[model samples]
Target: MTIAMGEKIFHHQLVYNDYAKLSRNFFNLGSLLEKIFKTTFLSKSGTQEGENTYMGNTGNKEIDVQGIFSSLPNVPTALFQSQCVVWKDEILICGGRPHNHHCYSYHTTKRKYKKICEYPHTIRIFGHVVVKCESDNNELTLLSFGGVDVSKYTLLMSYQSVWEKSRRKEKKKNEWRVVHHDTSFGTRKSNLTGASALIGGKNKDLLFVTYFPNKIDVIDMKTYHYVCGTGSNRLPIKSPYSLQNHCFVPLTSSNQTVVNHFLLIHKNLSLLIKYNEEDKKFCYESLPTCPSLATCDCYGFISFNDQIFFFGGYDASAMTEIDYIFIYAMKDRAWTQSKHSLPIPTRGCCPVLIGDGRFLHLVGGLAHHRTQAMHLATTVRAFDQVCFFFFFLSVIHLVII
Candidate 1:
């Protein structure tokens, strides 16, 4: 008999053995049935090579087994502490450790990468932050700040020019230009290393920068100057220690109490910072402690569907890499660990969400190792959140057989 489910066709055959033989194996019915079901499911599922399916329960919900992780093509070189920004259908990957200057754009649909442009001779690209800001004219600009050298220069590149340069159609000598040579926050020089930048404000003209030792700075994008007259740029509530290798993700909430809000994530802290339009200052409220706070750092962090997902990271105390996937639900303010982990433990990888928030692409990072600095990773893995209908089909088939 032939059965069709979606685009896949499955053929099944039933064989009848002698009644005497069946009676002799009556006590083995459970084992015999298990074997039959396993064979039937594996043959009909049509799982491809290098792909894996997992079945289990996560708390009250049944884990999405179809939403599995699979490897993609390796990047051109192994990289760690790199930065990536999604632009249209491509992910533009910038510099990483080992003094890398080359940048490439990974085509999400084609699953290939093409070298885009190299950083200027003066800039060190690793540990930098890249953000996409759209101007009033609807033109997109890519802004880069901070790096390993703790450079004070801010770089800006035209998105259109970058695309044209990638196609070899532009004749410009340098694609990136130095926008500000002495960018600073109040009395202190900007610490670009391990810093994070986000575009905010009602007009989207303000750039919020969160940097080391718990400091926040707002820069006017139009004039490229730090706003200081309204209030001090530093966070009113300071962390116990300096924050390095931290990240800032904008929070989306239905609450109307604040004009702008963001979540600051670190190894040991999670704080909610809100902008007060009336006071022209930023205030913060501490959230629950991170579940993997003691064991993870330099991991992949992203916000999707009101949830924060943390990928693999290095455990400094244990001196080993971790492969656990931790997720925090924003609505419930609770953390749940996913049964699924990376194919291999990695740290400092770039995570990009594409295609309707269902496909998460994890780019290069440092693989599992004892040393803290070496061993750049080259693998790219993707987690596909397959539809629940597909999982329903598999359950139905198992019950019917």
Candidate 2:
């Protein structure tokens, strides 16, 4: 590097040009930036040179299991992208790729997995969204929507079928009956993953479903009416391909109005889109590029105490599961990398919050070889309790390290 002052010139070595110095600089910059920006700027999942390393405690809270040794007892075949829903005392694990309609139930009390009676006729079960919806009458139902049949490469029926517990005299209490199969609505796009969520609003609940390239199907949960359309091509940013395994989650806040807002996350994008009830248009917030999250897909996401937690997903460079964990505090509108992480590297797993948002039940997904279902609870104090001055000290410690 050279600097000139009139006729006098001085030459110096730029620190960034040196590979060894650059890596150290990045760590320092990343730590400082994390304190200010509140989000991770460098991904810690991959082991490549220059990537962030674990300098602090590399341990996490120990996981608790009730059933057999490492797994949920009698957990069926190892499946990826299987949808797990919290229903009463059991967690329902349903449909995944290679197309099977059998739904399994994991009894929390019995500590075992049992097959349910209802078998879906739909063939396109891969990469679909299965949501639990409750009606005013206290009727609980599980809805299965758009997915692709990988073998045939064909889009299954978009009209969802609602699986409800049978109340009939002859039917078993645990048996699920497909009561309503609405054929009016259907989405052409298929092979979509993590592109759907059942959002709750002040007036009524709504379902937001996304399609490949750029298409969204917004359905009013109460009336089953939907608005299906693609975004304008002239928009500043483009929607990622839905088939690529992006995760979409609704931000539930008391501050949110009758309209709903959601966060869309993918390997390359982090977007916050809001639904305008009046204009029926979607608005995007201008946000900085999400650091490590912008580079990987199939991460597990869950919202607890108004904060969003993203953890454990596949590392593209290594082509293996990662144990990274990141937290986004909604009140501060900031992100924080956590020293705490999953016991095992995992992806495609569903996080279920239990015991009044204290314990997290991680349902089965692909771990090293389809991890056994496990429970996680913070052994430390609540995050809000230590978020005051202690937060700054922790950030400073990372910078010093």
Candidate 3:
């Protein structure tokens, strides 16, 4: 059974699958309610305003609004497979599909966008990775590398003190500096269309790049050189299977020992990659399968507390997009379907955590209809504020039965 109210949809099957095993013993009601209260209200830091800030009910009608989905300003252009990184108070959107080269900086507080710079004229923008790295002098730099472009080298563009200049109306043209054009890294096309990149290492000076099938590349941020040699920059562990449209998210845990761990997800398969600092090597461990894997693809994910939330994606078997949001708890090794969903079926949209990690800002992608081959470009921005308190209320109602 399904219920639709306003823009939200609730699936009875999902709720039943999760709560069907609950006992009907009324004596256990107190313990059950205690569990629900702790899980819904308390955050990882044991504070009411931390990671689970959105879940609290302050009794203020104006401030208590939760799980609300609203539209924001449209992007200057339709884009997907783009790269976004949070830089200070602004979000730098760079390199997307349709051979786009333009880059823009969206100010979070001002809610406005300013065209900053463009990718190199000779490079293709689609499927690229843009990340903030520190220079040798401890200055911040934006490093872009690995895309559909068959370029054999990586590029770096420094934006140090440029934001202040732009504010003062004295902006200067941004230039790309070729960091590594060495042909010795091989002439074979480095087409990392659906890859993931993150900054890691003991000193946080290493860039870890992972591409489809099974390949990992490590680069020294300061020197802008690819790390090579025995026990080299590449990880020796190999996967028995292949994955596409995957995502790598750093594990969010209170334990300090797991700080160097990352969770890699693709469909139902989830792997835990641990960075062994002693040997400077990485290893992987398989985790429980994701429940929504059978119907989710190209989804965006972000970790909070001990749970990972998956946003909209496509269902290849049905050839349709999905608005369902699924949550996987790392502690319980279980999945729960979110009662709230996106306003529309969306795919390939970038999911960004904003405002104390309570709200999710979804950028450009594609919106799909029920029928196949009918889709529209998602130019308008969407915001998803996750407040699962309503789901808790429904569970309470069921307990009364």
TM-score-sorted candidate list, best first: 1, 3, 2
Model 3 segments more than 4 A misplaced? 1-67, 135-139, 160-173, 183-189, 229-241, 255-257, 369-401
Tens digits of per-residue lDDT for model 2, 1-401: 54342333545465336645544454355344333322222122232433222211113433332111122243465455667776555667775543545677766655556676434463455666777776234334666665442321211221111233363323333443333444333444344544455565556576776545555557777666664453441223464433355666677565343257776666656677777766667777754445776657777777766567776888776788877777776666777777556666777766665555543555555665544334332311223322322344465688899
- Model 2's lDDT to the true fold? 0.53
User: Where is model 1 more than 4 Å wrong at Cα?
Assistant: 1-67, 135-139, 148-150, 161-174, 181-190, 236-240, 254-259, 370-401
Best by TM-score: 1
Give each model a TM-score.
Answer: 0.72, 0.64, 0.68
**lDDT for every model?**
0.62, 0.53, 0.58
On TM-score, who's better, 2 or 3? 3
Model 2: ten consecutive residues of lowest lDDT: 152-161
Between prediction 2 and prediction 3, the one with superior lDDT is 3
* Model 1: per-residue Cα lDDT over 1-401, one tens digit each: 44343344544345233534543554355234333333433212344542333221112322222223434555676677778877777777777765677778777656667777878868776577788876333235688777533445578877542344345443442266777656543334546677788888887778888877667888888888877565766664444546666757888654221246888877767788888655778777888867566545778888876777888887877777787888776777877776568655667777887665545667776663311221111111222112222333455677899
